[model samples]
Target chain A: MRWLRYLGYALGGILLAGCVAFLVAAWIYRDIPAGVLEAKYTTPASRFLNVDGVRIHYRDEGSGPPLVLIHANFASLLSWDDAVESLKNTHRVLRFDMTGHGLTGPDPSGDYSLERTVELTGRFVDALQLEHFSIGGTSLGGTVAMHYTATHPERVDRLILLSPGSLEGRSMQRAGRAVPKAADILKYIAPRALAEFMLTSRFGDPSRVTDKLIDQWYEMWMREGQRAAILARLRSYSSADIVKVTAAIRVPTLILWGEENPQAPVEQAAELRQMLGSAPGVTIITYPGVGHMAAEEAGPAIAKDIQTWLAAPTVRQKESVPP
Target chain B: MIAARPQLLSLLLLMAQAAAAQTQPAMDAKGWNLDTAPQSKTATPAEPPSTLNMRVYKDFDGRQQRIGDTSYAVDVSAVMTRCNDGSLIITALVIGGQLTPLDNHCPTTSK
Candidate 1:
């Protein structure tokens, strides 16, 4: 009977400790809704529109032909500010906070797969009455852009991939066996420091990762439902359809890389150009000391190149079945 | 105007294109017009047929091809140029091969 009482006491103590830890985490890592975030973060350029049941936050600027830019994972439309400032002078640059990131928050449909992203992008473009526009994106956005161009070759005039992830080697994109309920656990414990660490690690020049950049990233992460949505996106992500599509893209493709990109090495650019087998011709550009965030890190350079590419004739591309 | 210098330079280049000894293949335009041969799904065993990165000595008129000769221009090269403002412009009938720069014009301080 005494032994039984002792076991009961031990279990009670463990429960008490767990409850305390949960309370602390719940307080520190609580999600903040979009309304609160928008009040603090959005600028004069910010515009909101509902696309695929998500009230997407986007910005449209510049004046020439339409160019739609998608941001990286854990980043917002603001990520392309430097490039957009220069591009707007000659082009209509449109950037959106994707379904799970920035002020857009999460998709009500509860879907955050790359395919879901492509579908959302198409509907968004159609909603805006864009008959045809050039498309470009970085990292996760890069993957989505490539997926979109592959499937909707007719709709895209041009395609740009800035340090896109694992299109050639899907196995390497998310290596290691799945840890059960890991994403579930992550939903409850995101720290701003981790965001800072991740951003700095991806940057070719960490000195450029200012306090404002980290704050913007963390604020987006803290947006209500976003942390969970991001985790869901990573867990549900698939590059299974990429290889076939990469081979099917017939439009002129541009592959840009930062020589020091840690996330997707510069070598991957060569692999991607080879992957762009069907693309009539692929242009590869490497910024000597840039990194994964080339758009942010080397904005003017990319923008000028984009301007030149856009001015060129539309290279007729092959259509394919991919989504 | 995009920039006075670029605009002026573009006009000069246009003039140069008209006067150049070889007036680009009659079928061609401003940049090399990419051929209509579409790339197949299994582009692995055999490389797609296109002249990848043949440098254009001068920029011409794409519309000239559109209005006159063929469906689209065929001889295309992906061209990346560094502008005076330190910006870059990449031109193309771009498609295949490992994209190494056809020419790198790094600015030197001395004349």
Candidate 2:
């Protein structure tokens, strides 16, 4: 009889805890409607294009050679603000938030595969009537630009890869493996600290992760349907057969890496240079204290280097590539 | 016992964000705006509380919409960012009101 009483108490406690958790979440974490976030976070340079049914948020600045940049996973076009300012003065710099990220939110088609992202990129440039342009990306974006350049060699004049990711070894189901078992709970209860922690982890210098930056990131996460779209994208993540994909790139290539990049470390920079063997010319640069977000970490320096490389003739120009 | 950790963390984060949520960064800077764009092409731009470029789509989308018909589109938004003079310049960038062609989907609201 006493054991039965203990079981009843346990059940009651569990119910109470669940109720408290629910109430707490409800009070602090309501999804910020997309319209509200857009009005609050949209910058002076923001533009919206309804492409393939996805309202892609992007920026096109400067007025020379066109350069299209892609941001890293979980990040928006705002990540490249510093780099854009430096490059926009010379080349026509363009960058966009990937579907399911930033103001773009969820993709209406529900397709989050890498191939879809690449296709979206094609559609975007085609919409702009940009026949030819220099393509670049950071983190996940770097990987997409590489894939796009390989698939559409005619449209890409040069390729810039900054800490790109590859699913060469992750072709199988890798959902929620490194992720905590309680990952699903995250979709509903995203604490602001969690965002700060993630950004700080990615940054080489944690001190650089400012409160304002965290607010922007948190607000983006809070955007309506954004978190669900992000999780869906993660679950649907798969390789675009990136094995030996770099070898197919024949245009000039530039690879940038941060020495402290915990994810795609600087060591892989050498491997990337070797992989782009078919490229007419490859220049690889490594920043000492930079991390995965090199564009934001050392934007001006990267912009200066990119400007110089763009001006110089291609083909074995710099000895930066590892021999 | 372990379940309590996430709840505690959430409470702490809520407090932290509240403490950090001062509009000084927004007020000190220019403005913010995004898809608050008019659905009908012929609609007038809304007078926002703090949005900077809430005009005809003429920037990123390349003057896609003007005063009467088109506009622009860009993709960078930052709050509390100190400008060159370190002062926020929030104003409506109503370009030269250049008369651009209206999109087929966008009807002329000049009636």
Candidate 3:
């Protein structure tokens, strides 16, 4: 009877231990909603460039003149989803994720320089048989677009820059331009967590971040050779190149700014305006109460300006000019 | 034998309490403020306390993990409230620096 009592107590204790362990595990690995996780894994709109062996993820819907959209760092074609919807009816909009970004191929050549992006744009334009087009981009994309326009002035019609980061003088002053070097450290730590932190921090709202979102970025980061390409691009890229390209841009340029954007403050826009020297022709529009994503925050207004600016006589003249 | 068992049990209980205390980080007592009352499971922002900014942290096995990724939101209940001003001021809780109104948190009024 005493042995039976001891056995009962041991069994109860074991059951309790099992229950506790189960509870702790359940808390740690909470169920993720299927819809949310699946949504993150949906493949982006894609196109293959025969010349470069690059699978360019883009949204190319619309009718009128070609308008190419370029997104910022750590962003894919979806960043311009709002613009694509607004302009698809009137403009043949195009947006491609830069190499090492989104679903695009990580160029084995380790070439993510502004020149390579410009070259890829040229190839893509040629492949699509686009005679001339209006081009614009945000942040890093803006810099690439500017360089492309300046280098191949004949092919580009007009320019739209959204808080571009191209001031070499000031960029040099900032200590941590070592994006590539930092990437190595991030790689050693949890890559998914770091990417999530980097991306989530950029947004004005923290509540928007979700676990499934981090998982998708993690999958993308896991793509072989992608991290290397991203790091290489970071190490090789120079602000001086972008700054130098700005002066050579002869097309009608439109500068877009977000009032509360911490990344590219309004002061940078003011400086770009001063340096461009096309005060009347070069228009600077600000979206108050918006963050880095002004086009998204004020889509209709931006679309209207783009449509009008594209129709301007000078921009038209540049488009008609032979490449 | 009974006395010896009781003494052993007391010692074990004390050790367990010490372990628990050691593992748990000291809560910032001053920052404790009233969050909103419990709300339905509808998609809404996580209600925050007016007195203190409650950063979204995942307390897993007593470890605080910073949540990241701006793709979806987590659901939390604002069951507890701390006295602040005359009226309960409710701000949405944020995990990362970004804040969106999509988080689902139980409102303080639900109680």
Candidate 4:
């Protein structure tokens, strides 16, 4: 009887301890306030436009022909800050935080699918009343830009695909399977430490992962509705679906790649070129030692390339939609 | 009970490490070799002559047609800037040889 009583006491103690530990963890991993995040990330040029009930955060600067830039998944418009500064001198640049990212928060309808993103981008362009413009994006943003140009070729004067997403291929297929599972797990266990670690891993050089950058990324990830939105976007589409849509793009395309990109390997650049073989113009430039974050890593060089490409007599032509 | 407490503590530590590991890539080395390599540079074309003459023409059909010894096609309702080197930079719709900006009047709320 004494042994039985001791066993009961031990079990009760263990249960009480477990509850305390869980509560502590929850408190430690609590989301950062949106006000704090905005103070850190919102720049003087930061502006918001309501598209389909979603307020999009964007920056518009410079003068000359309009050039719209889209950021990668899990990133905001600020990711293109260096690139924007380099391009703004000679071009009218517009970069916006896509829905479910950065200051944009999340989609009101809880739909973060690529199709919905494409529709939102179309609406954004229409809202700006851009008769014709050049479009560019990095990673998932690259894929989004491709889809937008495919759907509205007459509106896109030129296209830039910077380390674009490729889910159909073998390397990306593996990433496609693993990323969603990780996001699913992360939705429930979103510790700031874990978020910071993930952001650091995206960079090829850990030294480039500054304390300020990590803090900004962690705060944005903890923003209201952002976690759920990111998870939904990860689970929304398949590699096969992306391949079907990408095969139809016919705009004059320039593909920039980081040779050492582990997430989206440099070999995928060749595949993208092949997929865009039918484009009126296809130019692929690979930075030898760079990695996944080329826009951030090699911003000035890329801006120069874009300016040169735009001025090239061979690439300059009136936009036309294919039959 | 004392033995179980140590075991439980170790288990919690292991779980935390595992969660941290999950956030990183599985590759052995995540760093890229950027220091040793020379940065890629884009070749810039020679600037056009500053004193070159400028001419413009009106294109009613929005086509790049040459007009009287000058290769200029002015799309109606478009803002066209003819460079000193005879290059054309268009910013808006060209309607009847006049530049018309797009009606982008969306309200912006500053953050």
Cα shift from native, residue A321, model 1 (Å): 33
Top DockQ prediction, candidate number: 1
DockQ of each: 0.06, 0.01, 0.01, 0.02
RMSD of each: 11.5, 22.7, 24.4, 20.6
Flag regions of model 2 displaced more than 4 Å.
A2-10, A167-181, A316-323, B1-111
Candidate 2 per-residue lDDT, tens place, A90-149, comes to 899888889988899989898988889999999999999999999999888987898899
TM-scores, in order shown? 0.73, 0.70, 0.58, 0.69
TM-score of 3: 0.58
**Model 1 agreement with the true structure over B59-80: per-residue lDDT tens digits:** 2343343332212222223333
TM-score for chain A as predicted in candidate 2? 0.91
Q: 1 or 2, which is superior by lDDT?
A: 1
Q: How do the candidates rank by lDDT, highest first? A: 1, 2, 4, 3
Candidate 2, B-chain TM: 0.18
Candidate 1 residue A4 C-alpha distance from true site, Å: 8.6
Q: Tell how far residue B80 is off in model 3, in angstroms.
A: 45
lDDT of 1 by residue, A194-282 (tens): 88898888888888788998988998898988888888887777766676878778777777777778778776675576566567656
Docking class of 4: incorrect
Cα DockQ of the candidate 2 complex: 0.01
Write candidate 3's Cα lDDT for B4-109 as tens digits.
1333223223322322223332222222111211222221122211111111222212222223311221222111111111222222221122222222223444
Candidate 2 residue lDDT tens string, B1-111 = 011133322322232222223222111111222123212222112211122112212222223233233112111111111122222222111112111111111112210
As for model 2, its CA RMSD to the true structure in angstroms is 22.7
Ranking by TM-score: 1, 2, 4, 3
